[model samples]
Target: MNMTLTENTLVKDIVNELPKSSDVFKRNRIDFCCGGNIPLTEAAALADISLESLINELNEVVEKSDSGEIDWKFWMEKDSEAIIDHVISQYHNPLREELANLSPYVTKVSRVHGGHRPELLKVYELFYEFKKEMLDHAEKEEAIVFPLIKMLDANTVENREEALNAIKELEKEHDHAGSLLKELRIITSDFIPPAEACGTYRLVYKRLEMLEGETFNHVHLENNILFPRFN
Candidate 1:
């Protein structure tokens, strides 16, 4: 059952799984490109697409090639040190670098053209907020939660209760961060840049979209694969 997943498995999750699946996760007319968090039941009702059909499609893709790739799924089944190292080395730092360049561009573009397209100002604010949230979020994961996950994975029950407590706190933080992200998405209208926007404006919006996609994948790895396996 989907209980193999965490509580936050929204419709957007299906989108993330599709790319890795090789076929079943298509983006055409599917709304996967936009709001990936809607429940599958909700999405099916909205689009008149059948849940059974979606399941069968996924099954076909899975059977065709349990493709021997070291995908996120592979890492999800790992210890805390493994997941933490992968996130910091592979995901977080590169995102920070991208945001560093993008933040100034947002301010610059808004300064030059805010009078014409006020939406840029809002976009600028949301991007900065997201960056700040992400910075703190990464630190929390590395400092506290990850160590516990690693400890538990290694079957070190000496500090098991303490690690469990840390995980509970981290889960609350995750909920807050997710709420903020959802608000940002609403503010940006699914990150569709205005038609009259310049390249940087468009690029920034595109980057946000990409980050959302990546973050969903990241969260899925933790929530569905790593956390459950460790638990």
Candidate 2:
């Protein structure tokens, strides 16, 4: 709270300076990743939240982290290739694995519970479509977007406009994926399990919650850090 924080500060900069501040932003449903360039005042307005309340929460988190506990900023300072590599290794690969592993559980849960809870059927359908779309999204990034970015980083001669356009397309895909996840959140009531939920039912929700968090961070890296450099 003692620091010179204000409404004009960039959301991404706030997250970079105080890594713990992401929790506050996430809790407030502020977009600190794709829409990170927006100022805090505007972001608060868009989220329909009080600016002062959000700033206070961010300051509190910063204060708590003053004990030298959570000092590591998330992926802000890395080079393009390093950032891309981290994205692939830390998020994309694991997401594919998780999707494959969780698909069965989702189907089983929906089949067993859909008799009473019709929502589970919708959940399974949405998740299946999301998985397929995300797989293709990852492939596009790996095959087309990421390589061009690395080329740009290396100063290699290529079609700059083409690469930029590809990045724009990738941003659109990110938005679509984000929208799908938001629908999933609404359908699952923020991934809360029912009173009659079985073990597999609970596990499906847990893995889904984890996937949502990781997907947010994954998109944050590309939308805020990687793409901006090329744009």
Candidate 3:
């Protein structure tokens, strides 16, 4: 059974439990990824949306969603190793490929369109940093952090504090990633392509929008579900 959602519910909790509700938050221009720790009331206020309307929409979608569709809760039932394995296969591997695939389009759009739309220049720079940061973050997770997490799960780690600190750092990195995504949205005007946009230009924006959604779901799993196990 779905819990009664209220204005006081944490944004991440709602997204964590009812994944489809992210659509409602997204449509309302709410940040349900990085800034998801705040309450719906706070998020609604920040987005300048009607709290009642937001709650109603969230409830409607959540009600329409089958309880078995709760991926977040499903993952919660798994062991840390299982969760880590799934994250690697489901998010980490695909993210690396998607970022690489989207790179050329981001560059082409910025190079061709930046003269008239200077914001594309910023988008280019931000995406460059975002890409580099994400790549490095994933490397750290796979090479160092994930192994330690698995060890911690098995009670084989001698340095529990070190593992804990590493998890905290990952959380900080997740916040930075969320900030970069928010800036991308701001500069791209919520990923709405210009009227005169070329095919490649429009494609980049669409991909970036999809990236935002994927990254949100990715981070939501880590920040709210996986990381909390260590905390």
Candidate 4:
């Protein structure tokens, strides 16, 4: 009833209750997995949302949410299927499409301006590797991991051992991919575009920055939320 309760509450506590699904969590930029441990006000500021509004929205969701997000930590203990599905649909598909459109632009710009900016070439090179790796990685999650995680939610322990073994391999790959993403960030210099950057260059930087942030959230969800549950 009291939207105020969600207003100043620590992000970590909220995340432990609301998860990535909570509208309040979404508005305030309270990353439900890795950076979930920040103060509510701080997270709101970082996300450019109103703290009070975020609280109000969350309260509305909670009041209406059939499965009231009373305990985020408890919800996380349930299963990883939902989070995986969200990633595949919301993040993966959109990202793949955006990457396809952006890659050619990056290549063209890099060829022309690379002699002067140089970072364009760096970004172009790293993006190629990142995009290629993610293309396969997303398929693996959809084809294999997603289904297996769903099985964990539905089936009993009869075949859990086999599932766990497969999940372990996926986890290792997740770590490796995480490392590569970190490297890509370094290569892009945090995706900073020069003031004099052309329109296309500016757009690339913006999208790359968004990609980095979204990817960070995605991996954190898998590593902290999904992987632990299944593995």
Candidate 5:
């Protein structure tokens, strides 16, 4: 397959076809997950990147990927159970551990720096809210939504409506989480630490940035790939 990316290509489509394109998007800070429905041109404009440059990079990746120089699996090609298992192990478990470990860093950074950088306080508060919501969301997925999805996938769903409603609710929660992440990015100026930021401050910013990226990818898999299968 000879794939040449154009401005009209959707961000999500690129990621779906060439998963490694996600690394390029991540490097450019382009949202290819929750906000990935837009075209490449629009995404570039939003991120203030040159459309030509973006397209060139993506097309290069596509060529290399097509040449078998990269390992890219289409998640949509996987069975529902396989996809669910991947999400749980690759995203859910790591997210839980990271959130727990990063919580203290957020608190410590905010408490120590809030007096000087009021934004850290907001980061602290938002992180708390996000942590609570994400942990609950993951638990709900494992305990309720995921099981229901499995039933739906296996054609043994007793209450089809219930499964559909659960998926809808989870998507709504994803939107809320995405909004919180956007706010965090804005408040922290794209997670850039201040000039006098100490070791802990820098570390917190880095970890928070990583958290935002991972959450976006997680939501993307569910919102664009997994949930859409049942929808």
Candidate 6:
């Protein structure tokens, strides 16, 4: 709201300051996760967007966002247990439900449209595979990795090595999920529905796009915020 952000600020720091800014970065195709450490001006240049324009859009989004309802910076002050619980309840649980619910639409669309739109077949295959992998990934985080993280938070000396190892493995899984998301984006032409696309087809693409955004934020929280504190 105050336009406090500048081009020199790191992309991740911008997102950290205003979590809703992620939608702006995603829309602009700016990398605010693995490459998030880079300054906003550099990120804008890499994405082929004008720095002044991007900053203006981000500020506008920040101004409109209800920061009082959701404070991204609050996570920085939370203890590890509280953060883990928030991640589980907010990201992990919703991801599980959405992945489960969206699979049916994906299947139905591919069945109806795969003849003309052959890419739907690939989309169907990739999504199911991604879903399966993600379900397993979420399971590991909930059953194994998360508990270890909490243990580390409690200063359990024996859990440190195991927690670090588990986190490394989880990061690898995140990379695999990211790769699938990229493939999905490419196959769907950035999730644009074709001209003749039916309502269901459009819905499938829309949900897929939503899935991509949610997963990016979910992974960002873990890879950037959660893991670093323990590691």
TM-score of each: 0.62, 0.68, 0.70, 0.61, 0.69, 0.69
Residues 198-231, model 2: lDDT tens digits: 6557667766776787788788878987888876
lDDT of 3: 0.83
Tens digit of lDDT per residue, candidate 4, span 154-175? 7754688888887787777767
| Top TM-score model | 3
Clashes of each: 6, 0, 0, 3, 0, 0
RMSD of each: 13.5, 15.1, 13.6, 11.8, 13.3, 13.4
Model 3: colliding residue pairs: none
> Hey, what RMSD does candidate 6 come out at?
13.4
Stretches of model 2 off by over 4 angstroms after superposition: 1-74
* lDDT (Cα, 0-100) at 142 in candidate 6: 91
lDDT of 3 at 14: 79
| CA lDDT, candidate 1, residue 184 | 59
Candidate 6 lDDT, tens digit per residue, 92-202?
Answer: 887787777677778988998899999999999999999999999989999998888887887774857767999999999999999999999999999998998765576
Q: Which lDDT tens digits does candidate 1 get at residues 57-152?
A: 655544532244347646745666767787787567766766665566568777877788777677677778778978887788888778778778
After superposing candidate 6 on the true structure, give the runs of residues whose Cα lies further than 4 Å from its correct spot: 1-70, 157-159
Against the reference, the lDDT scores of all candidates come to 0.62, 0.81, 0.83, 0.68, 0.83, 0.82
Q: Which stretches of candidate 4 lie over 4 Å from their true place?
A: 1-79, 156-159
Span of ten consecutive residues with least summed lDDT in model 6: 64-73
Q: What local lDDT score does residue 179 receive in model 5, on the 0 to 100 scale? A: 93
lDDT of 3 by residue, 147-198 (tens): 9999888899989999999999999999999999999999999998789876
